[model samples]
Target: MQTTFTPAQLENPHTAHSEQIIRKCVHCGFCTATCPTYVTLGNELDSPRGRIYLIKEMLENDRPADAKTVTHIDRCLSCLACMTTCPSGVNYMHLVDHARAHIARTYRRPFMDRMIRQVLAMTLPYPARFRASLTMARLGRPLAPLFAAIKPLKPFAAMLRLAPSHVPAKAAINDPAVHAAEGPRQKRVALLTGCAQSVLDPKINEATVRLLNRLGVEVVVPKGEGCCGALVHHMGQEDEALGFARRNVDAWMRVADEDGLDAILITASGCGTTIKDYGHMLRLDPAYAEKAAKVSALARDVTEFLAELELPLPVNKTDLLVAYHSACSMQHGQKITRAPKVLLAQAGFTVRDVPEGHLCCGSAGTYNILQPEIAATLRDRKVRNIESTAPQAIATGNIGCMTQIGSATQIPILHTVELLDWAFGGEKPASLAGVEPRVEPALAAAE
Candidate 1:
């Protein structure tokens, strides 16, 4: 894996990073065994080795990527399972990210595909826009069959089917600033108000706040913090992603300056993974680079921080079987392998591993909406594995995995923080009661 980069190409930061990653690979096929696409499709082009070759050629040639390369790259879930399997220490996450950004810049997709990607990039990262879209999806759910009749709109229709009917009305605040019921607090953390998570399940954030406060960490939901840009980044909208990153960095930095923040906790694994990489993502930016690095250092997954604190466990132990679906970002991307399960066990739940836990649930940010066929296949596979575990409830760190798995399985899907919250004295999730909540009636139809 040698690169002969031109002087001009080396001048570009992304190209230089891509070149370094290319040189690290020795064409070892070990990563293919754990790659979800290769495992499912049995196509070499879908494997890490194949993708590396594709990316190499695409970058080396400095030409717009052809449809074949775009197809193979698009098929990737960006789960980063390959990184865990690779003995060569190849940075597949960064490499694939560079490839995605290249594709978004150079590739001209078909009309329908472009439309879907555009809609997702425009809506998913904005809470207000996503909320409005969900309402429209609910009203339009009855006409799903009609929408499905059109080839271009079928994916949209399927995505609509997955939408929850009633999202929590607003973000929840559970710290001393908002909730006085919680006694003395030791640390004050600002919770990231994720774009999709806020609209889809504000309860997850509510659970996060409660769990943190119970652990003596006062949670703060800063007024201006918005999407973590994870969705747009995966879609290869780097500018939009970085813009969101800078805004968050500034907002959190302001909060830190004012109140002396301890850490920024993120409940969603995908967002957590991205926010932690802000230092690298903005390393080249002149103005916000230093600020981004500082903010990135302060970001932590809820479980990661809680595990470090050695928080007091709940005395009441419920004999509930739990299937832990480790989000790809948490396990592979962030290299946080066991914190969530260990936290669950300490909270007194029987945690079981879902088979093929390394595979993505097809909710790779905007992946489900943009690539429905492949996404549906992967989601079905994840659902089947979860069913095999025979667990009373399913717990995961990322909101995307929760929703994706929830759509495919009958068992209630709870955020890892939610279970932690419940164990510490919050109410049990309604879905675990053997009856799914009727608010998302469309989900009932999905079952």
Candidate 2:
């Protein structure tokens, strides 16, 4: 893992940082066993160690990204499972992120690839546009089979196939305002009403707000806050992603300066990971550097925040066994392993962990749409692991994982907060209507 960057190359901050990350690799290959691509594709180049070598060669030689390097790098899910598995503590997430940004600068993608990436960049971060596109995608969905036959149109086919048949109505919780605590406000927090999640399943944020309010936490959806920049950030759109970070920083910092926030809560674990990294992501910006660090310090996943609260007994506990599918971002990226499952168990459901829980569900942001074939492979693998648990339903903290797994399985997928909300006396999740919980022995005997 020795690096050979010249003095001039070392002068660039990003190069210097990436070189530091590259030097941490001990070439153990522990990552290969956990990498979804390497596990599925069996290509050395598709593994983190393989991709690290490719990244090192491209950066050290100061050459444009070759087809081989781009292919391997693009296939990466950025699940950060390698970071979790590495004995040497390699920061694969930052290294791969730097590699992606470099690819954006130097690699020229195919026309169709460029078009689809551009369309996703422009559309997904904006809720209104995303909703409209999904509506149009409904018409195009009928043509997915035709598109799948054409190689270049496969991403479109993936997009069409992934779009929900009915777009959810925009929830009122999305309005920029504050929901006061029921009694006294012990803590005030800003909720990240994310771009895709807001449009895809508004109930996540809704459930988060309701549950937090009942627990005496004031939830505010700041007016200027938008996407967490994760969607485009993973695509190597560095400038666009940074733009999103800056806007959110300004919006949330305003609340921090005025009312003082205890936490910036995020229901989507993918966004939570990126939002929590705002410190490192904006460290070079002199003006935003300190503020971004403060913002990142305040960021918390809803489950992480909830695990701290003193809970009353569940008002509507069920005997349902929940197969908790930990999102890659939640478990690997943020290292939040136990909060959601513990919260579910405390809320009176039997929580079971999925086998191979360290692997990604292949829903790393827009990965499913961009790399449909490989995505499908990993997703089916994930669905199989989830189903073996034989739970009444599946629970996860990410909207992306929910969508990806729900597409492949018959089990109802719901956000963890939704189940917690229902248990805490809010309305039951509509997805659970037909799922019958097992009767306890005593109750069955009494009946």
Candidate 3:
């Protein structure tokens, strides 16, 4: 794993980090067993160790990434399951991130690839635009066959089929101005109304707010808080991601100063993991470095916060078989291993672990859309694993996992917060009640 960096490469920030990460690896291939792409493709190039070598070579030589390297790196889900399996503690997340940024800057993607990436980066983070796009997608679903003449249109059709037929009902947006609730405020937190979550399923945030309020925590959804930049960051759009990060940091800081803040709660695991790393991501930014660090320190996943609160358990115990789908970011990125399951079990639900739970369900942000073939394979595998458990319901933290797993399985896939909210005297999710008419296989399984 020794790196031979040229003089020019030594000056590159990314190469330096790659060199540091490379030295930590003892050439152990244990990570290969857990990597989803490697496990499915059975190609060394798709494995973490193989990708690390490619990244090391591309960076050390100070040359533009070639098509082969780009293909292998792009296939990665960034699930960080390798990190969990590696005994050496190699930081694959940072290494893969650096590789992605390098690829975006130096590699020239196909015209169609560029167009799709651009559309996702621009629309996914904006709620209004995303909502409009979903409506259009629904309308276009029927016309999918018309576009079948074009090869690229096939995946678009698949993506459209996966889109929820109807947007979940909107939840009450918490007003930051109103600080006090009827009960004594035990703690105050600014809940991140995520970009995709806001558009795809606003009810997730509603459930989050309801659960927090019930626990006597004053939940504040601050204005001007846009995307957490996770979408762009994963695409190697560092500038755009950092811009969103700075805006969020400033907005939350203002709220913290106005009304004493305890922590920033995020229901989405991907956003939570990235926000928690804002400290390191913005360490070099002169203007907002210190402020970004402060904000990052305050970020916490909803389950993490709830675990610490030790809230009272609900009186009624429902005998339901719950298969807990541990998100890659929650378990491997944040290292939040047991909080969600413990909370569910405490609430009187029988929580069972899905087989191959560490493997990514192929919903790595927009990965399912971009790499449809491999994503489908992984999704099918995950679906099979869940079926083996024969659980009445599937519970997951991140929305991407929920939707991806939902697309593959017939069982009702729900956010952990939604299940907790329902168990605590709230109504069941419509998807679970079989009230919503949809073609999603997961919805049918719920019935």
Candidate 4:
């Protein structure tokens, strides 16, 4: 692959960065076999190599995004599986992100597409507003059929269809400032109570606190921490995303400066990937650049941190069989492939891998809502492979994957931490409340 950016265009920071990424590609079509859209739509334009060419053309010409380029780029899930598969080590994530930001600047979308994108940008990154909007979703759900029939408003129909009919009570919002370690403190770390995960499944936070406290790790919920900006960042809302990034850096830096943090533990793998990249995202900001790099250094996924702690093996735990669905962000984006499954096995559960583990489950942030038809195709394909493992429950590290996979399967879904938490000393998950807890005989004898 070749880029023809003029010397003047190459002087621009974004163009310079994209040029570096583009030059790494060797025109290998290995990426096509792993790309979800290419596999489903069978369009060369839908694959990474095709999109790279489109991006290279758009950047080199320094012109507005055309309909063909926008269509192919918008369909991309940004799963980063191609990054994992590429032997050349091309940085597709940053390249795609830069292309999206360019699209946001130059593409003039239709009225409905603009409105839908606006609604998502304004609401999803803010939890209280999102909850309020969800409250009104019932009124819109009835109109889903009508919206779906419209040419440009089908994503709006998908949004209404995915909205939960009943919002849970607010008691479990998990707003406590700090949870003290149950015993002598071994480490003190801040926990990211992110936007959507807190609203969608607050219990994941609770379980995290319990497991950390039991392990003698004090947990601090930084007051000003909010969304990780991943939801908006991937949408090409560059300034808004950077704004959220800086605010969170300020919030978390204050805590680290005052008390000291060994690690910043995150449960949501999608947020973890973005949080870990705060360094690269803010590299050009002179003021935030150093602080963002420091924050990224301290960030760690819960499973990553737990693996460091070398958690004690589970005692008297049932021999539960679990199909571990690795989130695309976890396995591919962050390259955290084995820690979660290893933790599951160490916690006394039989962990099995899904067949197409490298593929995205169609829950790349807002990808599902924005591209419902293609998203559904990938989701069904992912579910079939997961179900073939014959497991009693599914375990994952991402709330988005849990929501997407849960919609398609009746199998009990647990956050990897939730299962690990309960297996040690916490209460059994409500879904498994009736089942008696017992240790595997082989595990018991070994212990």
Q: Among these predicted structures, which one has the highest lDDT?
A: 2
Which candidate would rank higher by TM-score, 2 or 3?
Answer: 2
lDDT of 2 by residue, 1-447 (tens): 998999999999999999999999999999999999999999999999999999999999999998889999999999999999899989999999999999999999999999999999999999999999999999888899999999999999999999999999878889899999999889999999999999999989888899999999999899999999999999999999999999999999999988899999999999999999999999999999999999999999999999988988999966699999999999998999998988899889999999998988888899999999999988998999999988899999999999999999989999999999999989888889888788878999999
| Tens-digit lDDT track of model 3 for 63-110 | 899999999998999999999999998998999998899999999988
Could you tell me how far off, in angstroms, the CA of residue 317 lies in candidate 2 after the best superposition? 2.3
Q: Candidate 2, TM-score vs. the true structure?
A: 0.98
lDDT of each model, Cα atoms only?
Answer: 0.85, 0.93, 0.85, 0.89
Q: Is candidate 2 or candidate 4 better by lDDT?
A: 2
Relative to the unseen true structure, what is the C-alpha lDDT of residue 359 in candidate 4, on a scale of 0 to 100? 85
What C-alpha RMSD separates each model from the true structure?
5.6, 1.2, 4.6, 2.8
> Better model by lDDT, 2 or 3?
2
TM-score of each: 0.93, 0.98, 0.93, 0.96
> Which residue pairs overlap in candidate 3's backbone?
410-445
Better of 1 and 2 by lDDT: 2
Poorly placed runs, candidate 2 (over 4 Å)? 440-447
| Runs with alpha carbons beyond 4 Å of true place in candidate 4 | 171-173, 434-447
Top model by TM-score, which number? Answer: 2
lDDT of 4 by residue, 338-362 (tens): 8998888888888898998888889
